[model samples]
Target: MLIDKPLPELRRYRGRNPRPADFTRYWREALRELDATPVQPELVPNREIDVPGVECFDLWFTGVGGARVYAKYLRPKAPIGRRHPAVLQFHGYSGNSGDWLGKVPYVAAGFCVAALDCRGQGGRSTDAGAVQGNTLNGHIIRGLDDPDDRKLLFRSLYLDTVQLARVVMSRPEVNPDRLGAMGASQGGGLTLACAALEPRIRRAAPVYPFLCDYQRVWEMDLAKDAYAELRDYFRRFDPCHEREADVFRKLGYIDCQHLAPMIKGEILMYTGLMDQICPPSTQFAAYNHIRARKEMVLYPDFGHEWLPGEADRTLRFMLPLAR
Candidate 1:
């Protein structure tokens, strides 16, 4: 949660001159960036896990090279009237998949929800409470062999999120048109990127997302991974400085700044002024770049903790946002 951000007033761009173009460009870029391997997840239902009238299950999402990723999907047990709108949820970087177990708000509000487990992360239902106890190595930068591979490395986790949502939409009980994405911290960043990259998502809410403004993330040295990964990459390989810059530029091209605007759905971005992990300026940068109709909630004192009564506010906001 430690961030070395600069003075906020300095970077705050009150003058909005440039506008992000459209989602089409980002969508195509994501497709190009993704591998065309036969990626699929084997979803096995879990009748044991109890979710209020919603059948929840564990899913095994296979990544590009047959990497096994985990996910959890929840659907209304019995179809009520027509199919219900669905929400695919992701988790924070310092956290894992099951963190989204509290997503009953949307279900109780009459919707299906899919909460996915990020790979190399523990807090999966099968491995609950394991990583939290371990004073650990930074897993976010696990595959930082090269800067170009960082985003590619995150692909498995992010694609699992996107594909799991697509899987949920493939269900007869889910209203694909109403599908949306939501997450907090790193999850929030993923929510934004997934909403932008995955065109199917009609609504999005990114809360204190990580991995934005790569340059700033390195500057702040927030959590390890990113900086740690880059440092290690440069250290071990001693790659050309120019090569590293080019790699970061490509990474920036795939940055949330370029993608947030592409999300045509109603977006709700939330951040805290005191947030060390995600500086307010960077949050605002992404928010300002969001070309779609959106809303933002600023919490002055709250740090990494969940904002009190935020679910109600989100419900109220999303209920009316039936775009």
Candidate 2:
């Protein structure tokens, strides 16, 4: 089923959401706040997960709004007096970073790996939320009622990605110039955000990313799954569509599509055309805006879930950072 525009049209789709007039300035100020925020990073060794050649730790750092962000860090136990490349991983929406064993292969291949557990999700990271509105299902709608756009939950989450990279780069044994990021779904959105915010990120791989063009997703009526909260928010709060324009305008501040042009890293994005969850065009809306060296892998037969061999392909694509 063709869920979006044909591939050719998808290539040219800029996005349906309007970019706020102060979009650039808004992000600059947000980044400035991150710059001023002190990330008191702490790394505690996880003795139970250690292997002969790999070391694991529970990584924590202070993020925007003073949230204590969490991640799983792994590195080669014995580096041969040389710096190693690093990879940042973000998990799907509402999910924690997976077990330490999942990150071993990268460490085995001589790269330091850090996987983030998004704040307030099913993880150790602190949300530190003080929003004015709905505290329900969606992070998308969180703090929408606040007069301050900076209070948006995803804004803080996006900043957390950059904070994690900053923390990772500060390590003595990691190569600052060879950093990469990867994730699927919400994590994929974050991968793009992280690379866009931190231009030093050398590469990024985002598979079927969520949180792109919010209005487009609503128009396509694909807002019932991972985006169910978008629909729910409307049903309960604005049943007459009286606040439609205002709502989307607020969401524009955190949209990944708006952030794509700022990315300098080489991007390898994956999309499944049959995807009903995030929808294919929503993914392309962000991808088409990326001006850096980029490529897309299309799965005409797949959806938002598994696209076979994607894990191996991503591993190979990012492995070059270690070179």
Candidate 3:
């Protein structure tokens, strides 16, 4: 189906974000009813690992429960260093840290980078001269029919996100206070959650983040994973739209928007105006509720292709603080 629909009301507030709330109102409520859960960490410290110009180690941490999450600790070689600012990196939906294997701009810029592997997604860690660590990684779009299921599903994604981040910050060579988060698409959504849920996060840079306004985005657009799950859900049970909505209501309980407000830090969110995959209105819903220092870069023509000069622009905004 074509991707165009009358979205819920998204209006601007006086000297603030849109107050004329819509779907976010209900979604945020459910997230609150379910208290923020702590992410558990299982350190795989100092295992000999190799990347490009930098050396790295693998850190395996459990998500909400036994959900094994992976992260790569990348660092520029420095024989003498006690503390350095760290950047917790996340990959897009269905991507892994290896996708960023060659991007040494961050570490070369003098920041410790920990690119986290989204649990259940395809691919495994195969660093040079390092033992391979492979396991059953679940897809995020699975088990969308209910919250108890999502708490188990998303909890792994969310916790692996923060726990690896926590490990990055706790490193003897990194400053825990100067920690920040960045990602695109689904990773962007996880970035929002990590910054909010992890108190150690001082700043965030999310580009074309998915998972902001969940119910609303799912309603207007139909894509893959998150959106496809909903579409198939309705397809299988056409009898009860109410049942699907109920499931969504429960899922919203753990969404990033509800968690964004709790994060007190600087935020830089990049959004595409015509993005069908992640409707702009959904981005605003979360952007507005942020009670932190923030800004948005809205692209008029961009759909989701890493915006022209967006990588540099995003880093420019972040450098004022992160550097």
Model 1: how far residue 212 lies from native, Å:
0.4
Model 3 deviation from native, Cα RMSD in Å: 6.3
Q: Rank the candidates by lDDT, best first.
A: 2, 3, 1
Best by lDDT: 2
Candidate 3 accuracy as TM-score? 0.78
List ranges where model 2 is wrong by over 4 Å: 130-136
> What global local distance difference test value does model 2 have?
0.90
TM-score for all models, in order of appearance: 0.78, 0.96, 0.78
* lDDT score, candidate 3: 0.65
Task: Give all candidates' CA lDDT scores.
Answer: 0.63, 0.90, 0.65
lDDT string, candidate 2, 84-197, tens digits = 999999999878899889889899888999999888888888875733222336788988888987888899999999999999998988999999999999999999999999
> How would you encode candidate 3's per-residue C-alpha lDDT over 152-264 as one tens digit per residue?
35645665566677667767888788888888988789899888767678889998777765567565654354456556656676546767555555556456776777788
Q: Deviation in angstroms for 77 in model 2?
A: 1.1
